[model samples]
Each structure stands twice: as C-alpha cells, then as structure tokens.
Target: MRETVYIFLKAPVAGRVKTRLGAVVGMGRAAALFRIMTDWTIAEAQKGSWETVLAVDPPAAAHKRARFWPPRFRRVAQGPGDLGARMARIFRTAPPGPVVIIGADAPGLRARHLREAFKRLRGADAVFGPAADGGFWLIGLARRRAAPDLFDSVRWSSEHTLADTLKTLPESFDVRMLETLRDVDEAADLETAMFRGRR
Candidate 1:
C-alpha cells in the first residue's frame, strides 16, 4: 500500500482566505502569505516519497483546470462540511495504507516531519503534530481498521481542540504525538517570521 499526504488549502483570495490573519495584517498581505506558505508546503511535501494530494476548499476550485494550486498533482474537492466533517471524508475515503493530512498554516513544516509521521504510524494507530495554539497541524492514521468516531465532538478552534479530538478516538488505538509547532494565524504569530524574512 502507498503512503499519502493530503494538504488542505483554500483559494488564496483576499478576504476569502486566512481571514483571521487577514484581520490583523491587511487582507491582501494575508493572502500573499497564504500563497507563499501553500507553495512552500507543496514543495516540501513533494520531497517525501509519499503521494501528494490537494484537498481544496470551495469545491468549485477543484473542478477548475487552472486554479491556484499546481496542476501536476491530484486535486479533490473537500465537499460541504465543517472542518471535522471534511477531514473525516478523507480518512474514510483514502486508499488503503497510512494517510497523513496537514494544513499550510505552519511555516516550520518540513519533509522530515511528514517522514516522522509515517514512521510513527508503523506502530501507532494515529499520530498528531500539535500546534502551539491548541489546534493540530498534522494528523495521520494507520487505517488498519475503521475509525468512525475519530472526529466526534471535536471543538474546531478552541484550546481543547486536541483534547476533544483525542476523546473521540477509541481506547484501543495507540496514538503518537509530534513536537508542537506554531501556526501563523494571528499577527503575533507572524511577527517572528517577519523578522526572520519568512517570505
């Protein structure tokens, strides 16, 4: 079975993407940063041996032949749902084998992190890379068995996001944790990156 990575992305349109970050730093700037991060993530993901798939938002974007994302890789619509519903769709529909999912918000993401997720999945039923802001940046499942309750009652963006998600998993499933990384969701989160010339 082949390992795969699904990248969740929204169309990098001003006021439409990165609204939180946009509220802090002009919408156009936020959109530009979003594009840069998306591009960087795609390049890093391609460095890994696993297949790369873009799970695009707005559904219609996936249908367009010439969209913001690269045409070389496969693209699929995220469909209608909240964050958890959309993600659950991928876990339930992905091909046999381990599957890892990530968002483009974490600028520190590297190919090594993805490789580590797959490695941990060799023994663990699920793996999560926690975000400093209480959400998660990466989630992977071994998929040896079905997990219908994995996202049940998940509080999307609250401080208990990870904790709530963990509660949904079965007690029998062994889970692994990765290092906590910061997501560029607010102005403060982007301050350090700006000083470091992230772009």
Candidate 2:
C-alpha cells in the first residue's frame, strides 16, 4: 500500500474560515488568505510521493463539484466532530500504510516536511510537526499497531495541545518530532510568514 497525506481544510467561505485571523484582517481578506495558503499547501503535497487528499469540513463540501479547491485531488468529509475526532476518523479510515494529516493554517509547511514525516514514520510509531502556537501542524501514524486512544483528552487549541496528545499515547510508542513551524492563525503570524517569504 502507498503512503497517504490528508490536508484538512474548511471551505473558503467568508466569516466561516479563519475567524481569529478574520477578526484582525477582515473576513474577506482572511478567507482570501486561506485560499492562497490552501493552494500552496496542495501544490507542495502534490510534489510528494504519496496519495494526496483534501479532508474538507462542513461535510457537505465533499460533494460540491464547484469549490475553491482544485478538482483533480480526491476529497473526504471531515464529518461532524471536534478537530481530534475528525482527525482520528481519517487515521482509522486511511488505506493501508502510514498516514499523515496536516492543516492548511501552516503556510511555512513544505514538501520537505511531508517527506520527513513519512521518513520518520518508518522508524517511529508516530511523527509530529509542532507549531509555534502550542498546537501541532502535522501528525502521522505508522499503524503497525492499534491507536484507538491517540487523541483522547487532547486540548484542541490551547498551549497544552501537543503535551496532552503525547500523554494519550502508550508508553511503548516511539514518537518522533519534526521541526517547529508557525501556523497563521493571527495577524501577527501572517505578518511573520509574509516577511519570511520576502527574505
């Protein structure tokens, strides 16, 4: 079986996406920025040697033929749940072989990170790409064994997000950490990403 990478994204609807950043940059601008980031993310994922999927939110977005995302890639509904529940569903349902999932909010994410995650998964039971914000930008599982409680009791957006997730894993699990990246969830984060791009 081939490896897979799922990009979790919400429909690029004004006021519905990136509400935190939207509050600072206006809803329209926030939504537009989301589109650009999603586009860049998809392009980078395509350069990898794995199956690329768009895990769309709102559930209904899965069936829409016309949307902001490109039509070439496969899509799956994120279903109804908190972030952890939705991600666990993908892990449980992905095809045989290692599975990696990432969010669109991290603009600094590149194909190299995806490549590294899959590479790390080969030796470790799991791999995590930590974000500057206390949360994680990427998570991958080798699926060599069961992991039904991997996301249990995780604090979604707080600073303890990654720490709580690590606690949920069994003691025997050998987890690898990837380079820390910044997720564009606030105006300041966006500014930093843009500034880095100009360098």
Candidate 3:
C-alpha cells in the first residue's frame, strides 16, 4: 500500500488563513498568498510517489470541491479540538505505515524534505521539520512513536516548540530532525517567503 501524506490547510477565506500576517498584508492579500502557497506546496507534494490527502479545518476540506485541484488528491475536514488534539487524532487513525503531516505555511518546503523524512523514518520513531518560528512545519510518525503528548504543551508559535516536543517523548524514543526552514508566520516571515519566491 502507498504511504499517506496529510497536508493541513485552513480555509483560504480572507482573514481566516493568515491571521498573523494580517497586519502587514491585509487579510485579503494574506489569504491570497496562502492560497498560492497552498497550491505550490500541493503541487510539489503531488510529484512524489506517496498518496496525498488535504486535511482541512474541522476536517471538512473545500479543496476537494475546488475547481483548480489536480488529480488523485483527497480531502478530509479536521475534527473539533486544539491543534494537538487534531494531530493526535490523525496519528491515532492513520494507516499502518508512516503518516506525515505538513502545514500549508511553509512556502519553501519541497519534495526532497518529504523524501528525507520518509527515509529517516526507517530508523527513527518520528521525524520533525523544525520551523524558524519555533514550531514545526512537518512531522512524520512511524508505528512506534505514535503518542498524544508528542504535540502537547507545545508553545504552538514559539521557538521553544521543538524543544518542548522533544522533552515530551520517552528517553528510549529515537527522534530525527531535518533542515530548519522559515515558516511564513509573522510579517517578517511573509516578506522573506515572498522575496524568496520572487528569486
């Protein structure tokens, strides 16, 4: 069976997607940028061999109904809960093989990161792509490291997130880290991502 890569996305509705970048770029523009980033990430992920699923908020994804979607992508709405809870549910219900979850905000992420994470999953219990903002841009779990506390008590948007997450895991657990990338969260991050895209 093919492995599943879950891409998490917020509704591309203006003011709903990029609330952090809302101050710098108006909510409408933030939403637009988010849509573009989502498209780019989805397109890049599609080039890989694994299966793709768009796990939208409340698990109800409008992307599936989106007229612009390419082929072979499925959509599922997120369930009610905090970020940790939702992620916990996915780790719990995911298929037997490794399941990776990636956020939509990392405009610079690419297929190579996914390939590396899957490769690392062979020897480690879990893999994390740490974001410059202190949170993670991607997470992958093999059968061994599926635990709820992995995401608990994480300072969601702070730089301490990776450290906190690491502390939650058992000492016996073998974790792997990947190249850190800047996530388009605050105003500066958005500017950086936009600048990089222009080059």
Candidate 4:
C-alpha cells in the first residue's frame, strides 16, 4: 500500500516557532534551534521508504516561495483549524493508503520509529506513539476505510490529549500503541533530549 508521512511545521521565523522553549532561550536562539531540529527531523524521516509531505502552518502559499525548506518533498498548507481539525483533515484528504503524521519538534524520532508505526498499522485501524508528557508524538491510520472524527473535543497540548482522542474513536476500532518518545516543548525537554544525545 502507498504510504505518506506528513511533518507538521510552522515557518521557521523568530517569535513564531518554539515559543515555549523561547521562554528559557532567547526567541531568536529558539527559532534557530528549531530550524536545526526541523532539518534533522525531516532528514531522519525521509530515510524511510515512504513519500514525505510537509504540512506547513500559516498557509502554504506564504511559505511556498520561501527557501527555508528543501525542494525535495511535496508541500501543503494546513488550512484553518485547531490541531485536531488540521490533523483530521490530513487523514481525510490524503490518498488511499496508510498515513502517518508527526510534529517537527520531536528530535528523538527516527526512521525506525516511523517504520514501526507503519508496520503496526497493518493490523490496527489506528496507531499512536505515546509521548512522555501524556500527549502523542505520532498518529497513524491504516486508511482501509474512511478516517473517523477522532480529534473532536480533545484537549490538545494537555496531558489528557491522547486519552481524549482515543475516547472519540469507535469502540470496535483496533488501536495500537508505540514506544514513548519526548517532544521538545520547553527548556527542560530540550535539556533532556540533549542529555539523551537524541538532538
């Protein structure tokens, strides 16, 4: 089956990206760090044998002309909505096949992790890579059928985010969970990632 991996990213502009981390590090430094992390994440994700799609926030047209991102992958705008709505839109509109979505700030993410998620999707209707913070680092759908409204009413960025999302799915839906990974959000997270030699 065809597979597409979507990396959600914001334009790497100061004061726009990694704001939480910026609170500890300067905004300019945070943005610069984010740029590096984003590049590393994209490179690692591309190592997998799947088509890569970049889902940019703040509109695709605005960044399409921007030279920050590489020209190798396809790009699309993550149109209007909250995190859930935007993610659901990707699963809803993507071509028929398994689709895996991940954030650009997860420095610990690797090609093997993506391969594992796709592998699990073969048996499960949906798969989630749990984050240490109770959120999720990755979400994948087998897409053997139409995508479900699994993101409604979910408290994004909160500890209950993953659990809330799970509750929205049908009881019969077969779900799989992947290894816990930490996503860079604050200074502490960055410190941990660096200490772990992941970044």
Model 4 segments more than 4 A misplaced = 61-66
Clashing pairs in 2: none
Summed over model 3, clashes come to 7
- Residues 1-199, model 2: lDDT tens digits: 7999999999999999989999998999999999988888998899977999999988888888867688888999999889999999998899999999998888888899999999999999999999888899999999998886888989888899999999888889999999998988889997776447635
- Tens digit per residue, CA lDDT, model 3, 35-72: 88888889878878888887777444544466434446
**TM-score for every candidate vs. truth?**
0.96, 0.97, 0.91, 0.94
Off by over 4 Å in 3: 62-64, 67-71, 145-148
Sort the predicted structures by lDDT, highest score first.
1, 2, 4, 3
| Candidate 1 structure lDDT | 0.90
- Once fitted onto the true fold, the runs of candidate 1 whose alpha carbons sit more than 4 angstroms away are 193-199
Candidate 1 per-residue lDDT, tens place, 85-167, comes to 99999998988999999999888888999999999999999999999878899999999977878788898988899999999
Clash count, candidate 4: 0
lDDT of each: 0.90, 0.90, 0.80, 0.87
Model 1 clashing-pair count: 0
